[model samples]
Each structure stands twice: as C-alpha cells, then as structure tokens.
Target: MKSLNSDAFRMSIAWSRIFPHGRKEKGVSQAGVQFYHDLIDELLRNGIIPFVTVFHWDTPQALEDEYGGFLSERIVKDFREYAEFVFEEYGGKVKNWVTLNEPWVFAHAGYDVGKKAPGRCSSYVDKECPDGRSGYEAYLVSHNLLNAHAEAYEALKKCEKCIGSKVGIAHSPAWFEPHDFKDAADGASVDRALDFMMGWHLETTMKGDYPAIMKEIVGPRLPQFTQKQKEKLKNSADFVGINYYSSVFSNHVEKPDPSKPMFKQDSLITWEGKNVDDISIGSQPVTAALPVYARGFRKLLKHIKDKYNNPEIMIMENGYGEHFGNKDSVAVGTADHNRKYYLQRHLLAMHEAICIDKVNVTGYFVWSLLDNFEWQNGYKHRFGLYYIDFNDNLKRHEKESGKYYKEFLSQGVRPSAIKRDEL
Candidate 1:
C-alpha cells in the first residue's frame, strides 16, 4: 500500500454492511459504522486520502424485497438518504465519494444475464421470461439506479464542511474488438457494444439523460425522467471513475424483429457465430474472456478523453486474476505468471494515457488490496496481487506480484522489474 501511495487513495462503503437491509429506513448497523470508523482512522493515520464508494454491489436483499431494489423509482430518495448519512458521518474526514460501483454489471450481467447475485436468467431461446421478468424489467431497474445515483450526487452538494469532497459514479466500461475488420457492419457492432456497456451511465452523468437509444429500444417499458430530474443530473459527477477489463470482438448476426428494443436493429452476430438477439450472447464463444489487450486500454482512454471531454480519469478497478487453484502457496508460482505480465502491460498502457494522450489520468488502483469474495466466481479467479487462502478465513499472503508491486513503485517501473520473479 505504501509503494503505490499517491496524493489520493480510494475506498468504498460495502452497502450490505451498512444497510444490511438495503433500505435507508430499515436498518443501519452500528457494527458496520464502527468497521468504517476503524478503517477511516487507519487510512488517515497512513496519510492516505480515503475516497469512498457508497454502494459496491453488496446491496442488502431487504431493498430488493421492499421495492425490487434499484428496479423501483423509490430507490432514488433511498440511496440519496444513504449517501447523506455517510457524508454526515464521515465527510469531515472522508471527502471523495462515489455513488455506486459498476452499474453496468448491476443491470446487465446481474439482472439480465443472471451471472452474479440477485440472479436473472433470461435466454432469447424461449423468451417466455424463464425467470418471469422481461429484459425490459432489468433495463427499468437500471433506469431507476441511474436516477438514484444522480440524487446521491445532489445530496452531497449541500454538505458545507466537506467542501473539497465530491461525489461521482463509478462505471465499468467493457471494450470490444471487431470480429471482421474488413466488414463495416462488424465494426459497427463493436461500437454498439461500447454503447450498451458504458453509454448507459455516461449518458446520465454527462448528458443529463439516459441513452436515447434505450428509450426507443425499451419503449414504454423504459422509465420516465422528470424535467427537474434531468436538470439535476446535469454535471452530476465531478469526475468519472472507470473500471475496465478485457476487450471482446463483435460480429454481425441477424435476428427477427421484436416489439421491444435490443442491441441489433438489423440483428448482427458477435464473432462467435451466435445470433445477436440471443440472450445467451455473453455465454457464446464470441464473448470469451479477453487476454489483456493493452491497446484497447489506450483506445478506451482516447475515446473517453475525446468523447467525454476528458473528465478526470481515475481507474476504479483494473487487474487480472489467475486460477491455479492452490491455496497455502507463496511467491511467483508458475500459475500466476500471466497476472504479473497483465499488470506490466496495462501499466505501460496507463503510462501511454498520461504521457502520450495527455488525458488527465489521475490514479491507478490495481483491483484490490487483497483478494476477497469475487461474487459468483467466488475465489476461483484470484485477481489480488496478494493471494488469500479462503480456508484460512481469507488469510492474505503477498504473492510475487505484491512484492514486485512494492519494489516497482519504490524504484519505478523498470523492464528488469516488469517480471517480478526475475527481479
């Protein structure tokens, strides 16, 4: 932690611990507050600035019961209240705040694909709502989530003592590569992937509205934003937090026309030869895991820089995970060499952003201080620079990557230091 320490460090409020019920009025655990109190004191003691994320996907199931979680329009006021509570409690010490972490995952993968918690499993195969909820419903939930984020931003504006503190939303924008470079249609498919992935939240933050395409696609099912609400969304974030991973390739696939809107107007397939309209697209071979594409990192930075008018960029999450599956292990094992390599390439790419692009790049946090519960994938994909033995009650052991990180930061990025084992 000391090696990478810059002028700023970001932290988050695990929503589940705070509002174990996911409702503002339901319950606020004193234990949870104390946990943060201890955490904040530690960070301050270390001279590390704490930037807090209010919700990081651990929403209390209670909120889901009350009004379908973010699906309900009521979530706006509720989330705003939660933000205010945190601000009042810790704003004197903790200033930088992020309203939510990765709304795209919350909406698309969590609710739509049903991969993570609060699962939704809908396939285009039957379209009978296998889970009894429409794609439109997930989108609606996301619509509510965006509004809730905006409200939280507005609430922080009133806190006078926390003047330097600011609130913003953290967005995970996935990038795509074109499956067939020769085909114009295929290239357009790649851009559309960015549209659905990052565009949803960026629209709310910068444009003061939801995606225009979502309105026509989701149609009446899409939620309405009041004019006053629109006005408030303007400049909702002082900065945009980005969590990016690997990039995928998009291919064209034709599909039948639907009453509700979807990604494909003409039905294009992703590179794997699956239909674009299939709800199983992500599961398709075309949607396979990305090998750390560093150039994609550069392109994504340029896109956000030129398109988003170069908002201050702080990488909220960017790291690799390896699955050798051996616990009680130590430094630079053969299994995690890829993760070490992934870190070097991505950091060089980040250097490109700061040096070449001049894109106002601020900070780079490598995913986590330690490996923790990675949702459904569980402990299978170890993203941490430090390895955690889950059987040991999540005991953290610094990997070669971790030591390399400390030295790399202490000395500076060096080619000889790029691969830690060799160093």
Candidate 2:
C-alpha cells in the first residue's frame, strides 16, 4: 500500500476465520478479529483509508455443511449475526463497508455453472454437480443473499459504533451492447441481460422487487420476496459498487425448452465480443481476453445514473488480467506494459464519466494489490499491481503498472509520462 501510493485500500474478511464453525455458539476467534484491527491500524498509520468487505464469497465450510450454505434461508440469520459482529468490532474505524461482494457471481458460478466452491448444479448442466437445480437454486440463493444483506444493513444502522458508516453491496456487472444496434430484438436483449445480471439485485434494492421482465420470464422458478422482506430490501444500500472489467455484445435468443431450465439460458440472450459482421468492439490485449472496451465503462456509468436514480457509485474492482506463461521471468513479468495500458484507458474513461458525464462516482479501487490465488483460474491468472514471486517465499515485486498508478494517483494523469505506443 505504501509502495503503491494508494489513498485507500479494500480487503475482505474470511467468515471461517472469525467463526470457525460458522456460528457464534461454535466460538468466536478473538485472534481473527484482532488481526483485522491490527491491519486496519497499520493502514491508517500509513494514511490509507480502509474499505472492508464483510463477506467475499468464502462462506464458512461449517455453514455449507450445516444447511448447504446459501441454498437455505437459515444461512441468512447466520450471515447477519456474523456481519453484526464485524460492524460492532470495526465499524468505528472503518467508515466504508461492503456487506457482500458480488453475490450474483457467487450464486451463478457456484450453483448454475458448478465451477466454484461447494459447486452444485443440475446433472444436465454439469454432471459433477448433481445436487443443484440450476435456475431454481441460483435464484433461491440470491434471494437469501439479498435478505442477509438487508439484515446486515439494518444491523449496521443500529450499531452505535457504526454511527456514520456507510454499507453497500459490491455488484460485479459488465456492460452489454446490442450485437446489431439496428435490430430491435438485440437492443431489447441488452435490457434483458442487464435485468438478469444487474437489475436482479439493484432493482430489488431500489424498488423493493425484482425486474418486471424477470418475473414475467422466470415465473415460478424465480423466488419472491415477502412484503416485510421487500420493505427491508428497498433502500437497503447506501450506494452501489460496480466491479467492471469489460463489455460484450448481446443478441436475442429464442426461449429455451421449458423442461430444461438453466440460469444462463433464462435471460434469452447470448453474449459475444464481435458483431455478426466480425468487427471487434475494441482492442484485444491478452489471449482469450474479453476486448478491453473502456467506452463501455462510461456507458455503464451513465446507464446506472439514468436508470438507478443516480445513486452514489464506486468503481469497486477494475483491473486487467494477464496469463503468466511458464517461461516468463520476474523481470519480464514485472514490466507489465499491458496492465499499464489497460489501467490508463479505463481510468481515463472513468474520469470522463465523473467530470464530463457527471456520474456521481465517489472512488475507484483496483481489482487487486497482489497477485494472489484466483478462484477457479487459480494462480494461472494474474491481476495484480505488485507481482508475487510464488516460487521464492512469495516475495512481492512492483510491476510497471504499479509505478504508473502511483504517479497517476499522486500527480493525476501525466500524458507526457506515457509513450503513445503504450496506449
């Protein structure tokens, strides 16, 4: 953090560390709580503001074993209790808190695709995960997750230590454009994609219900909120944190056979990087990379402003990912020219949104500070400002992108510092 010259830092707490057995009755770890307090103190000592995420997809294994983790409504109360504990512990020091990080991704990837931890999906979706009902479980888990967030938000408001703290959910949403802007169905597909991906949570948080199109399409498969739960969910967040990396073109899809329901097919849309004419949306920087579409960042900001009542927004996670090859050396890896280019473009797009478009964006935090273990992709995917030498006692080395960010954060954008070829 001191090396990056970053003004703020964001970190997540592992629920298992705090409550090993996933409930207060099982026993709370004072050491775990103290560890965060010490870390927060060190950050403040170095003049870095701390933004803490109470939960970040790592539910306690004990919880998963107890009631199938987020699949059951019983997990909501457990999550609320855990969140309240954190609020009472660090709320006075940490004014900014994220109740949950990317619940949509968690629900979808874990239940729908069966790729993440405690993976579960219908046999038709992934034979390995034979326990889940793709569309049904995803919605059920999401419903529970939202209610848990509302409970946590209410708890934070009641906590005396958290008097002025602001709590929000971190949503990972990508911008979607029509594959053919002239095609009305494709344009409508964009809206449907957004509703399923983003509005599923944002609309519920803002309007106390799911999107109308979602209800109409998903029907009984989609979970419904009770009157009391709806009231609690409405205005449950102080702000919305969007974690954007790239955008894709959406094309309309015919409804799937009713007998075979999957969350991916429920939206009735397909995403692509290029249009039917084979024209790329933006430059592709890495292998298997989603095109680096910075314009989408600005477009997404304006969309949120116009559609979600212009709430205070924060760029929670935006960074470029690089695939490290076996032959790559530390010196070669640390140069990170591609990451520098990605950061430069996206930051510029964000500036345009804030200064030119007047999107009430409050802060921006890069996806990572260190090249840690990436879920599913594991260590193969690198998205860090500081390169981690995994083979050598996990030593940290600053990438060129880190240096660029240090300068950008300290001196603002210096066009002269960057070579034209870099962009």
What TM-score do all the candidates reach, one by one? 0.86, 0.95
**Could you give candidate 1's per-residue lDDT for residues 6-79 as a string of tens digits?**
74566778777877777656778999989999999998898777878888876667777776777678777778
* Global CA lDDT computed for model 2: 0.86
* Candidate topping lDDT: 2
Off by over 4 Å in 2: 1-6, 287-289, 414-423
The 10 consecutive residues of candidate 1 with the worst lDDT sum are: 279-288
Q: List the global CA lDDT of all models.
A: 0.69, 0.86
Superposed Cα deviation of residue 48, candidate 2 (Å): 1.0
Residues forming the 10-long window of minimal summed lDDT in candidate 2: 414-423
lDDT of residue 146 for candidate 1: 80
Residue-level lDDT tens digits of model 2 in 208-230: 89999999999998888999999
